[model samples]
Target chain A: MHLAVDISLRQGGFTLNASIDCWSSALGVFGPSGSGKSTLIRVIAGLAKPDSGYLELDGDVLFDSENRIWVPPHLRGIGVVFQDARLFPHWSTEKNLRAGMTLETTGMFSFEHIVKLLELQPLLKRSVNDLSGGEKQRVALGRALLAHPRLLLMDEPVSGLDAKLKEQILPFLARVHRELHLPCILVSHDLPDILRLTDRLVLVRDGMVCGQNTLEGLVTQRGAFDMMRRSGLMSFVSLEVDGEPVRAGVRPDEIMLANRPVEGLSARYRKPGVIVRLIDHGPTILCLIDTDEERLMADITPDAVRELGLKEGSPVWCFFKAGAVHSFD
Target chain B: MKSISPAEWTALLLSAKVAFGAVAAVTLPGVLLGWLLARKNFYGKVLVESLVYAPLVMPPVVTGYLLLVLCGRNGPVGGWLGRTFGWQLIFTWQGAALASAVMALPLMVRSVRLAVELVDRRLEEAASVLGYSPWRIFLNITLPLARSGIFAGLLLAFARSLGEFGATITFAGNIQGVTQTLPLAIYSALQMPGGEAAAARLSVLSLLLSLMALGFSEWLARRAKTGRSTHAPCR
Candidate 1:
């Protein structure tokens, strides 16, 4: 799915100016709170019209100020899973899910399919108000999918959930995008959550798209490195499937950079690779390493970097403990 | 205790018919106007609002006089009715219903507007995003959510219609077995010396009915106001 947004909107006293041209089945929009991330999601969902620009989603003109064209939200066939899980409180879970389905719904994403996919069978007859936070979010996600939308817009879908509930809902989000092949724009302030789904990231700061790149690519930019450090730049890694494929993560702090390979070491991953870039902050330098399989980021002290002579194109081994590779299933 | 005389029973039945007819006539229009007033902002909003509420603040006599001029025989609406349907509204039971509805309209509008405004707007927007048309959302969400408020408003309007007098007296007249509602019957009874016992009985029933209507309406409104389970169990 491709989206082109060159728009400016003034809401109250804040003006949001964003220009993003991205194509990804799972596009992640990451930003801090009050950075207009949700506003961007709303614009894409056609919930809010841009003041003076154009928006084309998958070749459909959603909004074009110059042409006097504006598509209504329901006509856009774009579904939104709001942050607060705005399910109709008076309706049952089954009713809420069916609310998104029209007569045109085909056999692909049928009622039984989504119900089984989201595991909503047991909760179908229950009142929406009676469901737990995680369950409500799952229902909200299923409802949006049942709409059969070309693009799904989720604004802080799991931000309101607690840590345990968030852990419960993330897998459903991943399955929706991966198995169903649903194109979604997931907007959230949490970086790790977005990384868990897709690395194709759009960084929004102060109502503007500060940078747009994959999580690995963004790590190489000096400006992006410092900003990402504030949010803790822990890059996601797709581990090779021995029997079952599992997505793993490596925190920048867990990675140790070495100039020469030592004979004995307990760290599981010790691959000799080339250093692509170096981002120097005040006390430490963030090294971007390109292994044959993936790009890894390791944070080491300036003293270590100076001693090892780690620079662009320098050969080094990125080491991390076996336990440091956190698996997401 | 003596049983109700035929005249008193006729008067009682006519009052019920007029009040029931009045409530029925105003309900649909009242709800529409209430929703419009609560949701829309357009040209001459204040003027439209004031006109809807004018009957509430103005003396009932003035409203009666206006209705009399507009709907009386030889008047535009009365003449059209006479010509089109060969029916007359002046000095009839339907005329009393018209007067009662006019007097009770403001109460209905005010109650329904407040109720519709209290419905969560986000829910409606969510329905819209879920592919519901505005009318369907109103039918499925807004109306059900505002049900208690509307019931309270209807009861209040019914109560107001039950006791309507000045306008009914002016426009429909106090003819026996026709427009002589409970209050009109009581007013007629008080003028005669031997009508004391009958008037006393009818007056007590009227007061009791009014109090009961008001009490039930208040109870329903308070239940909704306290955020209770009336909003629960809506399919």
Candidate 2:
């Protein structure tokens, strides 16, 4: 399904002006906090009315300011999984799931299929107030899926979760996309969370769509890279070694330093580079190394930096394993 | 532990009947108005709110006088009702029930409105996305979640109705078997010579009734609180 949105709205002092069109099944919206990510999703979900512009999904006009056509949220057939998993407090898990089934649609998602897909059989009898955060999110996903929505919208579904819970939920999101084949828009401020779900991203900043590109493509853009760096996205590089293309993401924490290239080690990718800059982080130092093809950032401890006498213009051998490299086509 | 007399028995039964009638009369409108006050924003909201709560702040006699002027035989509303429905609200038990309902409405609205406001609006938004109509959302989600507050409001209104007097006396006249509720009976018992024993006995009954109502409300509130905490998996 193709989705098109071009909308502008002003509330108080914050204004949102964004326009994008996407045909990809899973589109990730990445931005920092207070960056109008939620506002965009709210507009598409019909929760917030835009001052002007038009929205079309799969050839249907969802909203058109000039034409004065606006479909209410319920009739739009768009399902949203909110960050807080806003389940009805008075209902059991089963009832909450059943409440999402649209009256006019049936046989799309059966109760048993949803229960098994979300592993909700054990939680069906439990009160919504009794479920954990991860469980609540899972139930919310089931609820939305059971609605047989034409388009799915997720707003920071795993933002507040710990590492373990996030890991547990991300796979379910991927499975939902793959198994259901539903078009979805996932909004998050976390780069890794968006990477886990989809590679196609729309970068948003200051209530505007900066650009839409792949994660690798985004790193190459100057302004987008600076925004990503400020938001804690590590530098990624795509290179060609021995006439074979290689794509790898270098995490700031994984890059180790050595004065000379050591032999008898399992680390596959070792490159000799000159230290271009050294930035003092709170507890560690961020050292930027100028390799032949690209620049790599290494986070090294202050003690090690002092021991090695590392400074700007120093030559160092950067070592990392092939396993640490995340490759994409 | 004196045996109750026949006159006292009639007054007690009448009080229960009047209180029940008053509560029944106000519940649906009270809840609707409470939800409107809690959720909707419109012109004259403050004026509407003040009018709803006028009975609570104004003198009971004044409220009674207003009700008499509005619903008396010669008044516009009373004349229309008499002509259209052949209904009479003056100096009858129904009039007493109406007066009691008006007196208790503000408290009922306050409790219910507070509860409705406390309900997480996000839940309603989620329900809207799930294809539930506005009325269905209220019936299926809002009302059930606001049950505890509604219960508290009902009990409070019942207690206030049982003890209503000043408005009841002015609007519905204190006829023995018709409009004399518990508080009115107590007042009547005290006005006669050598009626101290009856007055004291009726006062004790009123005290017991009030305690029971308050105790039940407290218990329900505790249960609702515990239910919320026990089921809440997060802080």
Best by DockQ: 1
List model 1 lDDT by residue over A1-329, tens digit each. 98999999999988899999998888889888999998898888777888889999889888999999998776888888988998886667888888878788665578898999889999987878889999999999999899888888888999999988998889888888988888988898888788878889899989999999887778767677677777856865665545665667788898888888876889866667899988876677777888887778888898898888878999998777878987777
Task: For model 2, give the interface RMSD.
Answer: 3.5
> TM-scores across all candidates?
0.90, 0.83
For model 1 chain B, give the 10-residue run with minimal summed lDDT: B226-235
**Candidate 1 lDDT by residue in tens digits, B52-139:** 9999999999999999999988899999999999999999999999999999999999999999999988888777777777888888
For each candidate in turn, the interface RMSD (Å) is 3.0, 3.5
Off by over 4 Å in 2: A215-220, A229-266, A269-329, B218-235
DockQ for all candidate structures vs. native: 0.46, 0.31
Clashes of 2: 1
Q: Clashing residue pairs in candidate 1, if any? A: none
Instruction: Estimate candidate 2's alpha-carbon lDDT, on a 0 to 1 scale.
Output: 0.85
